[model samples]
Target chain A: GENVGLHLPTLSVQEGDNSIINCAYSNSASDYFIWYKQESGKGPQFIIDIRSNMDKRQGQRVTVLLNKTVKHLSLQIAATQPGDSAVYFCAEKSGAQKLVFGQGTRLTINP
Target chain B: EAGVTQFPSHSVIEKGQTVTLRCDPISGHDNLYWYRRVMGKEIKFLLHFVKESKQDESGMPNNRFLAERTGGTYSTLKVQPAELEDSGVYFCASSRSGQLGQPQHFGDGTRLSIL
Candidate 1:
């Protein structure tokens, strides 16, 4: 089955440094991609999203880069903070309202 | 505005016991979705409802799992004769529309532990 997968299961970064998470998807028909953050004891929260038509999209301190040619997506966070510690997942819209999610990457911040 | 809200943050039941999970989506949001994460696996979609109508249910694991959205306001997922594999975190999400770019707001989720 076509799926979305992450490059790393866990990542540790120093505070104030930048962090990057990578995701690879197999379904080329997916037209929309999103990034979500999940803290302990909570559900996945929306972080940012990018449309297939565009290759890059930016939010407050986050940027989502989409490479349609390679079917790869990356989320870059500027100036990692303590609150940034969580599991980050990349999801692609498979159908009208169905989202296919990756295994997720646990991001830990070093203070 | 209040985001998606789910009832009974956690549930513990035996293998044969039945469990019903409820979700109250944001007001006026007609699109509702159900998803679950089992152990180490990624979140998987279960079903989707559009204004009390099931738009898609291809992700439903089996007939043992039933979902209903009455009046297109709140929805419930019922698992009867649950099995050990039914244990996981069930999350409910809602969006104002089914548009391509609309982001779905999620609830905290209900953790079900099947013994």
Candidate 2:
């Protein structure tokens, strides 16, 4: 059963514009969340992460907001660039190093 | 330090054949992990290794799958008589801190296609 899924499978934004991607998780027991960026033909690169305790965390040009009340997570990119075009994933960490990733959201930057 | 690296970016073979996937983690990383994403499925955990020892292997699909992390420097996953269901992307990751739930660096996955 796919418990983790995004509201949108794809999102497109203009260059220099902001982009937001949302994700919904089914498990209430998940205590940690992380955001990753995956480019074509490459492994996922860690972006930012937020714990259940913190509602928001900021890193570089990206920010991760967590809403534990609704089990929702979102990633926001400022002034999205062409290099930012890739599949974005939200993952939940249960107990150990195991991460359950969402379906994934492909973000495209239109120049 | 160089990040994790996996060999044979892609593979294709008929069913009932054996295949092996390898992963080389970061220089000082002590935690190594294996995960797979089957067709139309999420990335599922395959196993975890901490310093040449298996910590968790609860996600391995069946007995045909064997994973080893000798010397804790690198890891290998072997699939014997692999079935068609084994066709998918296998990803390996590692972390510097051998703690549970740490941020993991990944290797470009190996996409295995079984006919």
Candidate 3:
């Protein structure tokens, strides 16, 4: 079965350090990918997105790198802050309108 | 502009009871989606609606769950004879268009507890 999965369940980082969360997707037909941040008791918030046609995309303090050959996706956060602590999910646009999400990586930033 | 809004932020129901979750998507957003996160599990897509029609419902767990989006403004998800395993947080999201790669704005979600 096709699914999206995370490389790690949790990631701990010190404040001002960089954080990278990795994901692996099995479906090669997926063309669009997105990263979302969800705090405890809240819905997932959109962070950044990348299309399979491109290898990389950048946002404020965040970057998403996609590798089609290995079907790997990564989200990089620069200068991790306390507020950046949350569960980060990587989702792929499956089929027409549905998005399949990865297991997610709990990002913990220590001050 | 208001984001997606869900009613009854939390719902508690006994097994075999019925519960309906409501979602009011962002105004003029023609695309709406329903998703769920079970305990200790990642969020999963349930279904999607493009206006008043169902776009895709492949993710719906079973026939016990019924979703309707009349008038294409607000949508409702009804679970009949809910089971203990039905306990989870239901989230609603909306996007300006149903086009591929469009970002979906989400609501806080309705927590449903079936005891």
Candidate 4:
């Protein structure tokens, strides 16, 4: 069986601390990268997005860093709260093609 | 503007039963799309509809999944004879257009459990 897909590594952080979730994308041609958050029994909510032209972008309490050099992207959450605990996914889109997503990283915040 | 909306937050049905999920995108948005996330898997694109026509449905898993957007408004996805592997969350989203960077607003999703 051929393995190695778009799965991401899980990240765990304590409440009030910072958390960083990383993802490695497959397609270098992907022009835009987005970060989404999904809580239990809920859908993925838009967090922030950055293009291949930029290295970083930020929102209220979260920031997305794109390292095109290594095809690596990451989301940094500041002062992580339990409410922010959820499954975080990184999605890549090229042109008008369908958006492709990583396997998702479980962000567990210990309270 | 109102966000994308989906019907029946959750649905549980026996295998081989049929189920339908509905979605209403933000008003005036011309591009609507459907995505699905299976258990322990990444979210996969199902199809795209521009107005009342299906622009792209390359990701549709099989023929059992039927999608329609009548009158270029709300849309529906019908899954016939649902299988155990069909249990998962289905999401609907809409974008201003199919540009490279346009963001797609998503619905909360419908959780389907095939027993």
Candidate 5:
């Protein structure tokens, strides 16, 4: 079965430094990708998304880079903060409304 | 505006007991989706509803689980005679429509524990 997977299960970064998370997808037909953040005892919150037509998209302090050729996607967060500590998940749209999610990466900020 | 809201943040039941989860999507959003995450696994899609009609239910594990969205407003998922493997977190989400590339907003999810 085609799936999306993360490079690492956990990541720790120093406060004020940048952080990057990587994901690889097996399905080439996927056209849309999204990043979500989930805090403890909460739902997955929308972070940012990128369309397959574009290689990169930027948000306030986050950026999503998509490599269609390699079927890889990465999320970069600038200036990591304490509030950034959470589980980050990358998901790809498989069909019309179905999203295939990767195993989440737990990001911890070392203050 | 209020985001997606789910009832009973947590549930604990016996293996043979039944459980029902509810989700109230954002007002006017006609697209509803159900997903679940079991222990140590990624979130998996269960089904999707467009308005009051089921658009796709390929992900549904078995007939023991049933979902309904009456009047296309709120939806409920019922799992009868639950099993130990049924314990997990169930999440409901909604988007503006069936349009491609629309982001789906999620709810906090209901954590179900079957003993």
Candidate 6:
């Protein structure tokens, strides 16, 4: 079965440090990848996205790197802040419609 | 502009009871979707609606769940005779188009607890 998964369930980073969350997908046919951040008691919020044709994309203080050959995706947050603490999810667009989300990685920031 | 809104932020009911979740998407957005996240599980897609028509419902868990979007505005998902396994956060989202990679704006989910 096709699935998206994360390398770690939880990650802790000190404030001002960079954080990296990794995800792996089994479906190679996926054409789009997205990163969503879900704060406690909130729905997933779009962070950044990348198309299959691109290997990397950068947003405000975040970046998404995709490796189609290894079927892996990663979200990088520069200068982690306490507000950046949340569960980050990596999702892949299946076909042209549905999105398959990874199990999510809980990111904690130490003040 | 206001973002997506969901009613009754939380609900607690006994097993075999019924619960209905409501979602109001962003104004002028024609595409709506339903997704849920069970305890310790990934957020799973429930269905998608293009106006009043159901575009894709392949992710709906079972017949116990019914979703409808009348007049192409607000949508509701009703779970009849809910079971313990149905306890989760139901999230609603919307986008302007049904395009492949359009960003979907999401609302705070409805937390349903089946006792």
| Model 2 lDDT per residue over A1-111, tens place | 121232438899999999999999878988888888887667789898888888998988898999988899999999999999988888898777778888788899999
**Model 2: per-residue lDDT, tens digit, B1-106?**
8989998899999999999999999889998999987877766789999889999999999999999988889899999999999988899999887444468888
Instruction: For residues B1-115, write the lDDT of model 3, one tens digit per residue.
Output: 9889999899999999999999999999999999998877778899999999999998999999999999999999999989999988999999999666689888989989899
- The digit string of per-residue lDDT tens for model 1 on B35-54 reads 99887678999999999999
What is the TM-score of each predicted model, taking all chains together? Answer: 0.95, 0.93, 0.94, 0.91, 0.96, 0.94
Score candidate 2 by DockQ: 0.45
Q: Measured with DockQ on alpha carbons, how good is candidate 6?
A: 0.46
**Per-residue alpha-carbon lDDT of candidate 3 for residues A1-105, written as tens digits (9 for 90 to 100):** 011233448899999999999999879999889999988778889999888889999999999999999999999999999999988889999567888888888
Candidate 4 residue runs with Cα over 4 Å from true position: A1-8
- Cα displacement (angstroms), candidate 1, residue A91, comes to 0.4
lDDT measured at residue B75 in model 4 versus the true structure, 0 to 100: 98
10 residues in a row with least lDDT, candidate 2 chain B: B96-105
lDDT scores in order: 0.92, 0.87, 0.90, 0.88, 0.91, 0.90
Task: Return whichever of 3 and 5 wins on TM-score.
Answer: 5
- Model 3 chain B: ten consecutive residues of lowest lDDT: B98-107
DockQ of 1: 0.50
lDDT of 4 by residue, B19-71 (tens): 99999999998999999988767789999999999998999999999999999
Residues B1-115, model 5: lDDT tens digits: 9999998899999998999999999999999999998876789999999999999999999988999999999999999989999988999999998666689999999999999
State which candidate, 1 or 2, has the greater TM-score.
1
List the TM values for chain B, per candidate.
Answer: 0.98, 0.95, 0.97, 0.97, 0.98, 0.98
| Tens-place lDDT digits, model 4, residues A1-111 | 001243546688889999999999999899999998877666778899898999989889899999988999999999999898788889999766588988888888898
DockQ of 4: 0.42
DockQ for model 3 equals 0.46
| Model 1 quality (TM-score) | 0.95
